[model samples]
Target: MPLTTRRRALSTLGAALAGAVALPAGQALAAERTPPVRPLWRAHAHNDYEHPRPLLDALDHRFGSVEADVFLVDGQLLVAHDAVDLDPARTLESLYLAPLAARVRAHHGSVYRGARTPLQLLIDLKTEGASTYLELDRQLSRYRQLFTTYTHGRVRRGPVTAVVSGDRAARTPLAAQTVRRAFYDGRLTDLGSTEASFAALISDNWTSHFTWQGVGSFPDAERLKLRTIVGAAHERGQRVRFWATPDVPGPARDALWGELLAAGVDHLNTDDLAGLEAFLDAHGTD
Candidate 1:
């Protein structure tokens, strides 16, 4: 090789090395950073506590909402679907509150990193509404600013939003709260009549309202009814969710979910975590 050609090659290599060395550590990291994963905000893990790993399983799937059934026993709020299945070790504070607090701290005041919107924690009360909510309030108070608060006429967003479901009687007390850590979940009847400030979500049994079970094709009128319901709720500044629909792993679940998405339903309730995750990804709903 010619002497000048060799000198030029060496100088080029030296300049490249100098540029690399001059790069800031944080800037180098920024160059290597991958875009954040889109959160599946519409996926609601029904009976999330029933899973083997509970909250961890749903978080791994990037689920935005999770439901836990709680029973008030001897001033302790225990999480379980039924009274017969209640376990002392599965208290609300242990399974949810502590872990959520730790996660918010770890993520720097958000459930998801670099995101301001909070994750939804749906607490279904299986016991006496008023008494259970009072105890739940006490437990929530210990966490300070962990859960979202409705103060005066505005909602102060936090790391997590707790929506109270189950026990129709709970509505009376939940509505009466001047300042509370949670919002109430209403039924279909309350869709247009209810305010979003009081009832944040409208949930009902899918089987009760529509006869189409995601079989061959959804009836035209039934689809219209579903869309109507969703539209009404959206107009009223509320979200819609229906349980008791098909959950089995098959085309039926996919069809129903597709229909729900097309109708603009806010949350898709499901017990199968991976199944719903796959469905939502395929449709790009996140």
Candidate 2:
């Protein structure tokens, strides 16, 4: 099936999943505490801002990571994929930050009540990387306790870990931070170029490096390349995620997801929230 057709079908599936899985009661009851659920550590919600419920939807399925693209507009960070789709009310603080803060407090310093792993919040840059990241740093400072931080030579764990992606220029300013609440997201080439403290994640488009689309048997050479990249990233204590892979709902997509897991890929990127949740749950990744 064509990628577009698969996306449409997956979007429909995602909508249904969002509707069926309600928000956790812990979020609604900030004062009342509830035990945290097991997190799907490998699950990463791609373009999570597009979801009807944003962070909540992924949390409902216990996703460990979520991506949000933001444009630095009029001194405000607005969440959207493109300039034409920007909405004034869809500020980063409203859609992600504040809600996360509330949830962390509700869960008592953890995104998923008692889960030790901090949730990964990937902020893909949609504007100039340096200036936008500086502004983002300012915003992140307001919720210092809510995010993981790196200072001097020590790393402090918080409920959420913000990793900056997109425009490569952000790396310059990010590298200069003496104390930063956000980390950099690098490409596969950056695997051994820097330490995990600087670039916490290594992410790139899967199609750019591979010719296969999960059709028949994956080429042995390509499979080796995939495993090599993952192994290198893991050796450095950095996580790996490849976006723009097969997201169409079918055997091909399932096959690709399976390969990713078997190869030790840290994240399974998908727009279909429930689709990934079910796949991981069934496969025992939960």
Candidate 3:
């Protein structure tokens, strides 16, 4: 073939190759720009057992932190908001632990697809603190290989991290355990006082009396209070979350969420997953 013809052919081939290579990179860039697969502040479902679908409801709501109140009955861990409400069929393992374990396995140890961080499992014990924790330890041991374990200051990769809430007596003994899995969830009052090195997160009630609105104009006093709380928790290298925040379907909820986001609160307590997702979409960091 003539030189001119050869040159034209070569150029065409180069263009095709370039297009092939650039296509994937361009597609990848688009995927990267897509909204994050997970929420900014971890969405927590309080008393998840109370929800109609229980564990499924929490998962469907994209709740990164799920609360299960369990009572120990006849060597079984029954899940319920109160002891009288306990059902034999709704054991902690059946309702949550087992499903969570299977899910972590299915999702490669994270609730969110492609998530690197383990989802938080906040188990609120309602039985005798010591016995409940002991039984919990036994049950958790069955899935020891699937929980996030920490030592000193390092986090180990695993399915999830189980943090005990509701029973204060469980904290000291839990801390004394030599086990790698499981940790304590501390309260706001214990924020600056705990010597427990493995307390994963601090959670508390954010009452309606607390004044925080999403009006882009937070009260200076409340802002300072929030900053102090979040800063102190972060200083210990732990995350902070609040429950019982306004769940009302209006400005009240938005305001509190806004302030919580502004204050750098790690998790936002909300049963309204779609609402939270919309808000995060509007003001997400990503």
The per-model lDDT (C-alpha) reads 0.88, 0.91, 0.76
Model 1, runs deviating above 4 Å: 1-35
Tens digit of per-residue lDDT, candidate 2, span 112-197: 87787999999999999999999999999998999999999689989999999988899999999889999999898788898888
Q: For each predicted model, how many residue pairs clash, with residues at least 3 apart or on different chains?
A: 0, 0, 2
Residue 158 lDDT in candidate 2: 93
Ranked by lDDT, the better of candidates 2 and 3 is 2
lDDT, candidate 1, at 201: 91
TM-score of each: 0.87, 0.88, 0.79
Candidate 1, 41: how far from true, in Å? Answer: 0.7
Please name the candidate that would achieve the greatest TM-score relative to the true structure. 2
Query: Which ranges in model 3 have alpha carbons more than 4 Å from their true place?
Result: 1-36, 39-41, 151-155, 195-197, 208-217
Backbone clashes, candidate 2: 0
Model 3 CA lDDT for position 259: 79
Which candidate model has the greater lDDT, 1 or 2? 2
